[model samples]
Target chain A: MQTEEEFKDFILNGHLHYIPNVSIDCAIFGYHEQTLKLMLIRHRNMSSWSLPGGHIKRSETLVEAASRNVRMHTGLDNLFLQQFKTFGDPNRIQFNKFDKEKWFEITGLTSWEGNWLMDHTISVGFYAVTDFSETVLQTDISIAECAWFDIGSLPPLEFDHSEMVKEALHTMRLHLYHYPIGLNMLPEKFTLSEIHALYETLLGKKLDVSNFPKKLIALGLLNKLTEKRSIGAHRSPHLYSFDREKYTLALKEGLVLS
Target chain B: MQTEEEFKDFILNGHLHYIPNVSIDCAIFGYHEQTLKLMLIRHRNMSSWSLPGGHIKRSETLVEAASRNVRMHTGLDNLFLQQFKTFGDPNRIQFNKFDKEKWFEITGLTSWEGNWLMDHTISVGFYAVTDFSETVLQTDISIAECAWFDIGSLPPLEFDHSEMVKEALHTMRLHLYHYPIGLNMLPEKFTLSEIHALYETLLGKKLDVSNFPKKLIALGLLNKLTEKRSIGAHRSPHLYSFDREKYTLALKEGLVLS
Candidate 1:
């Protein structure tokens, strides 16, 4: 670990004694196995599971800080990122007298020993959903390992992360029915069933195949590609991709997720 | 305006107490004259115009605080209230210097002053739209009169109210484009032209008459009221109100203004 002296004269000086004490955490979700899963890391210092998050930097906007943190920890830059909620409640943070020794080691070198870091923290939350098969991530050193936990079965998280995950999943599922996700997460050309599967995974329910395509087609937010997937031998479903210009404009005016 | 003795023990004991410091402000809007209008109150102590807003009470929830503030100021209640945005720029409060002398007269009591009073003021914003014809309101004593200003021809507002109005209008415009606002704003039954006119005004544009009904029908968030309008002789138009249940459900799921 770097000495406190090495970090003191840097930007930490700008923060100096004035760290706002707030952090941003993202419930980065990836879809696979017909289930929604969240990205989490095993903290090397603490030997506990935690959501991928970091403190807000002095020079960054909150949204920018959130986006940058997601990219920095997970190596998933240019991914779907959106601030969903902000959690603020007193008495949320607690470290008993016994836990302080280990807690300080986990937080890294610190100046004061008898007190916790900062006064109170308010965390801004962001959520993103993507198909896991497409991503190649670079895990940061603080993260012992990065893995996805199924929405139904999350491990015990260090803070209010489990609640954050649940809220994010619920938010994502709620959006899946009304809004199309192909604009950011889906590949250029994907099959009808693949999109349907993604939707089913998000909604956690089966969908009627007949009217779904007709409804999507009528919106004119999708463009059918002439090509079809070669891997699936039973039937070649028409490939489709989001119409960027129209999708963006639809998003701007008011698009119901239904 | 209570005395210092009434201060809570926790509040008085701390040098840097973290009060939520949030206030609720409503951008109450009404429709009239084939144009969108906003209900604004003249600043109590100054010639400046501002949205009717107030500090939230300690015992109330945010929504309750907003609703109460609207009713207290405009004397209009039982309306659809929506929180469109939360402004927390760390610099928003420092924008306008408090009119101390004027406030002293308006409240007729002095307890808080200096840093404590300044720190006591952070705000959350809400906006509502209603048809002005159906409601009666009595203005609060602080304002000379409540006036509806055309969205375009608004006077300069005090303390970031202009931006608040802009945000609220944007939210309302998004709602008019997507969700059905029948029972919520319009009467139980209304002509297609009335609905169309409302949308046209909020959207700040014109709509193709023939095509508008089809789009509304396609959304299925609205109901066709069978009642016919007997007032004007312009080809008896149908009367309808908003479908509250579907609209509420749609909104909860991810209804966004594009």
Candidate 2:
């Protein structure tokens, strides 16, 4: 980590080389084991959590900045991402000054204990959907912890990250059925029950079991395999997978995620 | 109009109170006479026209800034507004230096002419929908003219404002039928044909006349007014208006715009 003077210089002088007063935050939503999760990071010496985010370099587009942050925090790449919203309230940065002071205290940076970190800034919010089972959380010197939290129960986050997460969820829910987002979260082949569970997790409510399957089948984006899996007590459920060509065509035509 | 010294002071000192590297642009789209249009403004002494935009103030939210810009460019209030996208390409601002320099030259500013106006800034795009017949263009000292241009035949705009307009149109189209936006652009009492014209203008295509009315009626939000409108060489069409209470209920239930 840089000393107080170096950090101050990085803010006042070096930051000009990047896009000043602008940041990008990623609300990486993942699906695994029939649950939806969001990736969050805790800065070194800070107790409050926040989404993995950083400033945009002068040479990069906003999407590239979000992609870089997702890779840096999750050790995963080529994830499906979308820009959902931009949060630009002037008070967003300074809303968590107490957290900053606590962080400074633990880090022993007395000289840097001021409003420098709480300057007015705007943040663009991007969300990524990835397979939670394949992602490995990565930590750097500045990041004390990086992990996925259950969507239903998230801890208090610094700044307006909680609001960002809420907004991302709302946008995703609005676009979920119309887009092929859930398909990317599942494996190459899965059961009907697995896809239904993913939708329930995202929508935060159990769908009508009998009606949902019929609706999904009517959409005709899936191919039922001849093989079946038999649970100990239940009847055998046939395996199914997305027909890539049909799925793409349905997505292009704005069909519901079936 | 500010003098050279005043302009310099505004740029160097006054702007410090606002977020340095973030701006807001307004793409005010209007519907009038079966046509869609966009509002554009020309800065004093600059040939290139641009959207009405300004840096976000430290005391205001992004939506407030956008609302202020819409009011500044068009003398209309309580318009239907939404934030569509953010344009953050580093080269978006300074790419049009000749116009910026022209603005500086006419303002009689020499001290702050080099790159002060060309700073790296990210612009949050907002779009407003309004009845075009009711809006009056407002021009201030810094603005040479404010005018509405037909969406189908827009003149060249400065920087990336044209791209912003295109993006806003695309978003509005996607959400058009899914939201109650067309109601805001229509009068209190209108014929079915009038509403159809507005949708056609917005969607950039003609709808199936026989099917459009049936689809709208199925939503069950409009009231049949005991009025009719007649045009030359056309049959008199019955007038209709929204049942305010039922409309609000349908809107809350996420009924497609009708």
Number of the top candidate by DockQ? 2
What is the docking quality class of candidate 2?
A: medium
lDDT of 2 by residue, A1-258 (tens): 236555445544556556767889999998887788999998765678999888888888888889888888778887767778899886787544454455454445554433334467789999998888888888765677898899888999998899999888876775665566666688887888888887787777777773444555677767889988887677889888877786677555554332
Residue-wise C-alpha lDDT for candidate 1, range A17-118, written one tens digit per residue:
222445678888887646677788875555567778765554455566777877775666666665555554554444332243443454464544323243
Which tens-of-lDDT digit does each residue in B36-86 have in candidate 2? 888899877577888888778788999998888888777777776778888
**What lDDT does candidate 1 reach at residue B206?**
73
Chain B TM-score by candidate, in order shown: 0.76, 0.83
**TM-score, every prediction:** 0.67, 0.83
Q: DockQ score for model 1, please? A: 0.13
Model 1 per-residue lDDT tens digits across residues B1-258: 133333333233323443234456799887764766788877445667888876544344556777887777556776767665555444555425545555544445474443334552335678877776654655654455667777788998877778788878776655554445545456556677776776677678777773455565565655787777677667676665556676677665544332
